[model samples]
Target: MLAIECAGLTKHFGDLTAVDHVSFEVEKGERFGLLGPNGAGKTTTIRMLTTVIPPDEGTAKVLGFDVRRKPDKVREKIGVVLQGLALEFFSTVYDTLDIYGRIYKMNAENRKKRIEYLLSEFELEDKRNERIDCLSGGLQRRVQVATAFMQPPEILFLDEPTIGLDPQSRRKIWQFIEEFSKGGYTVILSTHYMDEADYLCSRIGIIDYGKISALDTPEGLKSTLGGGDIITFGVEGNVDLLRSTISKLDYVEEIMAGDELAARVENADEVLFKLSEEVVKAGAKIKNISVRKPSLEDTFIKLTGRRIE
Candidate 1:
């Protein structure tokens, strides 16, 4: 059975449409991702699927329960970690986890054991006595996510779960999510970070302007960039001339300039040799040139005409 489904799901906020006829499905035990920038309908889609809010139009289901007609059934099987902080201000770490487990009707012995395990897993044993509000932002974020696992949910929803975490803390959470998903659990996480989506998700949906523009595995999405490779050139002089000269090449399908000049081409070897000649003719001194596989950022630019950020 599919873990979640959204067919022609739509949501509107006054004059703006937050989600527009969105459609997708996630298989059981799959780590699915919603990749998009802020206000691009990622959160709206999650909200509807989690039964936090109803879609303005269309149908959605979680674990085979229709979100609109059987919301309580859907809610009974999922865990949600929202973007904003939802932890108690004065509760200690131990109390927070214990309280959540208690609400799910977990027995005392099992709840105690789960709390102890989570305290160790989230590296929060030292903070067990500390109030939630007294912890650092990243630590508090960990506590919020930890609460979701208090009952071992069958489906987990994470919306920008690591938005404010540092690099080290971010990787820690990534490892945790990866490990947690191994026990036949389904995860649907929404994130704007390209690397985060690439590293964590088995499949990704790229959303923009209230619509899902593309959906595929990370490598699959990269392969859609005209089946080409990326070549970036670092130059010393005549940057514009180099760009113009490269742009005229027959093999160059797309050329862009930022801190450096880059192009997407069908054949890397042929394009490199030809571009080297053009650089000399254009009066530019070559600093460096590299050939690399196409990336998700490249695919996003091709589909959305801008970076996710």
Candidate 2:
């Protein structure tokens, strides 16, 4: 069963359209990613899916419940961790989750079991009694995520879940998300971090100006940019001289030379051979050379004029 579905989902704020005819489907247990830069309609889309707001046009369904008509049913099956920290600074982590459990109408015994399991899963058990204001940014993020899972909803929506976290905390969150999927929970996450999406999502939808520019698996998206490889090398001598030499090469379409020279080449090995010999003849020192496949950023740039900062 599909956990989430949107058919031409759109949202407008007065005259401006925040989300424009967006459509996609996330399968059950899939870790789906909504990728876009700020003001690209990612948050707006999340709000609509979570039934926090209604769409001006189009439709969305969460866990088979219509977000517009059956909002309560949708809300009952989904967990949301938004970009902002929704915690009360004066409250302890335990109390914050306890409150949500009560709101969900979880019985005392079940709530206790759920809270204990979540605290341990998120590694917040030791700091359960600590006030939100007393925790570091990473710890606070963990609490926010743990609170979302306290209800054991079938679907979870996490917007920038690891934004302020350190490397260790970020990895811990990733592990928890993976484990959540393993336990049959479908995760829909929004993030500007390309590496994070690449690591966690089974499929990613790249959005911009409220529209989906691309949708595919990470490897599939990269392949859409074509199969060519990128070759980058460093030159110790004059950059201008290197630029003039490399730009004229037939296989090199784009040559950007600075402290380093990067080029999009049709044949990586051939270009490297030619460049190496030419640099030697020009009396320029060769620092390093590397060849890599196109990245998710590369695919984003190819479709949109801007990068996903």
Candidate 3:
């Protein structure tokens, strides 16, 4: 079953079109990623799906309820941890979760049981009575996540959940998200981290200029760039001449030269032989040569002319 679906979804703010005819589906119990650079409409799309804002055009359905017509029903079935910290520093960790439980209308007995489970699971039992402002950033994030899970909704939407976290804290949060998905909950996250998307998302949608430029598994997306071999070499003489020589090779698809020349070739061995003979014949000394598979960042660069950072 699809936990989330959007068709020709669009949003605009005055003259700015934040989202433009974007469409995608996320299946139940799946880990999906929304990847894009800043101002690419990822946050706007999240707001529309979570029913925090209405889309100006098209439609969206979350957990089978139309976001426009039945936002209340949709909200009941999903958990949201937005980019900004939503917690009140004056509230204790225990009180924070309790407030959410009350908002969900959980009975007193069920709420207490759920709180106990969450505190223990998140390792926050010891910090329950401590004020939110007194905890470390990581612990506070843990509290945020724990509060979201208090109701155990079927789907969770996290927007840059680990942003500004230390490396150790980020890894811990990733682990928590993975474990959360294992319990039969669908997880949809939007992040600017390429490695995070590659690591956690079963499938990723790459958005740019307020539209989806590509969508697929990480490996599948990389494969679309036409895999062969990429070789970079520095030649001691006119870099332009080196570029011209490498571009003339039959096996070479592209030759890019800066301080060095990087060539894309179908047959690395044949291209290397040709390049060696040509450079020697042209009296240019070869400095270095290395071949490598294209990374996700490479693919992004090829498609959008920008890096994900």
Candidate 4:
């Protein structure tokens, strides 16, 4: 069964439509990502699906339960880690988790084991006795994420799970998320980090201005930009001649300029050799040559006409 499903799901605030007829599905054990810039209606969609808020139109179902008709059942089967820290500052890490476990109705015997496992798994064993207020931002985030697993719900909803974290902390969290997904749990992650989504999500849906702009696997989306590599270089002489001569190659797609001449090509090595020869023929020498494969970031810009940030 689909772990989560929505059809023409929409939400509005007075005159503004926060989520405009968005629809998608997440299968069991799938790592689904929602990609968008700020105010792209990603978080609003998550909130509705998690049943924190009701949609103004259409329908949503989580884990076989209709969100509009059975919000409690949906909530019981899902876990959420929202944007900010969601812990009580006064409680110690262990106590915070213990409290959450109790709230999930976990019995004492199971709750104790779950708490111990979470502390160790998240690398929070060292901070178990530390008050939530005393922990670093990364540590606090770990605790918050661990709390979500108190009940180990079937579906997990994460909104920007790694925001404002250091590289190490972010990777650690990614590892935890990966391990969690391997246990056959569904994860719906919303984030602005393109690399994170590209690495973690099996399928991605990009939203813009409250609508889905694109939806597919990372490679599938990148292929829409021609499935080629981007070649960039600087020419010391006669750039116009170089552009005119090199643009004729069959593998070359198009050229753009910012700090240097960039050519989108079907193959980097093939075009690199041809481009170098063309530069010499045009009486220009190449410098600072670089090759970049198409990425989700490039696709996002191609679709949204702007960067995710």
Tell me the spans in candidate 3 whose CA falls farther than 4 Å from its real position: 229-248, 251-291
Q: Compare the candidates by lDDT and give the number of the best one.
A: 1
Per-residue lDDT for 1-309 in model 2, tens only? 988889999998989999999999999999999988889999999999999999988889888899999998998888999998888899998999999999889999999999998898888899989999999989999999888888777999999999978999899999988888899899999999999999999999999999999999999998876668888777688777777887787777776422456677777876679867876677788888889877887777677667775
After TM-score superposition, the amount by which residue 14's alpha carbon in candidate 4 deviates from its true location, in angstroms, is: 2.9
lDDT of 2 at 51: 94
Cα displacement (angstroms), candidate 3, residue 269, comes to 7.9
The runs of at least 3 residues in candidate 2 whose Cα sits more than 4 Å from the true structure, single-residue gaps closed, are 233-248, 253-261, 266-270, 276-289
CA-RMSD of model 3: 3.4
Which runs of model 1 end up more than 4 angstroms from their true locations?
226-228, 234-244, 256-260, 266-273, 283-290
lDDT of 1 by residue, 13-127 (tens): 9999999999999999999999988989999999999988899999998999999999999889999999999999899999999999998899999999999999998899999
Provide the TM-score for each candidate, comma-separated. Answer: 0.92, 0.88, 0.85, 0.89
What is the alpha-carbon lDDT of model 4 when measured against the actual structure? 0.89
Candidate 4 residue lDDT tens string, 85-183: 888999999999999999898899999999999998888998999999999998999888889888877999999999999898899889989989999
Give me the candidate number with maximum TM-score.
Answer: 1
Clashing pairs in 2: none
RMSD of each: 2.2, 3.1, 3.4, 2.9
Those runs of model 4 whose alpha carbons end farther than 4 Å from true positions after fitting are 234-250, 255-261, 273-287
Residue pairs in steric clash, candidate 1?
none
Q: How many clashing residue pairs appear in each of the predictions shown?
A: 0, 0, 0, 0
